[model samples]
Target: MATPPSEYAMSRTPHFQELRMASGSDNLQGCFHLLFTQQYAEIDGLINVLCEKRDDLFKKIERMEKLVEEGEGLCAFHDSGNVGLEFMKETLKTDKKVLAALTGLLDMACEGRREKRRHVSRFE
Candidate 1:
């Protein structure tokens, strides 16, 4: 399983803390902006990794379907091939939703950053 971006971000706290410590109060905001930018990059990477995992799972499902079709209607691993198929379908559906939520989160975060930049630029 892939580690979530939020959880992975925690591991980067020390680096951000170092940046904060190195900066004066006036530059605190700049440090935070950098943090957000780095986080966006990480989230983007996470999305790519998840998409790859999803693709691999889809390939596995195709292989499983072929195997079940060749075998008697019953699955050796699962009680019935049909049941296993339905299970994988449902699992994929759930994963699809999760991926959508993650993408939405990334979109919202990016939008917020853009808005903040616009607001700041107007004053400068």
Candidate 2:
């Protein structure tokens, strides 16, 4: 009977000579098992490194989202202040009252912007 395909292939390769000699087997199963185990270990290590990098990227994305939220809050605050200033100027029509309200609105807006900046800077 002709030799099995695995034996025939192994017998033709110079690399398997030592394994064949050491195992004294025609199947070469031991050589295949050792190679597979080594490859699996390498793949496991690579997967762990990839998982760590994914977690780091997730944290960075969360930080960026927080900064964007802070910026949006600041923009909304400024828009509301502008609306209030326009309304005061139209309805009051008195220079002194309008100026006083405008000054207060500006002070509040500046304080809000500064608070937002401080919050966003924490993420950086």
- Give the candidate number with the greatest lDDT: 1
Give the poorly placed runs of model 1, Cα more than 4 Å off.
1-17, 21-26, 73-124
Over 1-124, each residue of candidate 1 has an lDDT whose tens digit, in order, gives: 3322354654677665566555432354666665555555665676566567656666765665566465535554666766776766676566566656656765665676566565445433
User: lDDT score, residue 100, model 1?
Assistant: 68
Error of 2 at 24 (Å): 11
List per-prediction Cα lDDT, in the order shown. Answer: 0.58, 0.53
Point out the worst 10-residue segment of candidate 2 by lDDT: 88-97
TM-score of each: 0.44, 0.42
How close to the true structure is residue 42 of candidate 1, measured as C-alpha lDDT?
64
Model 1 residue 115 CA deviation in Å: 12
lDDT, candidate 1, at 110: 60
Clashes in model 1: which pairs?
A: none
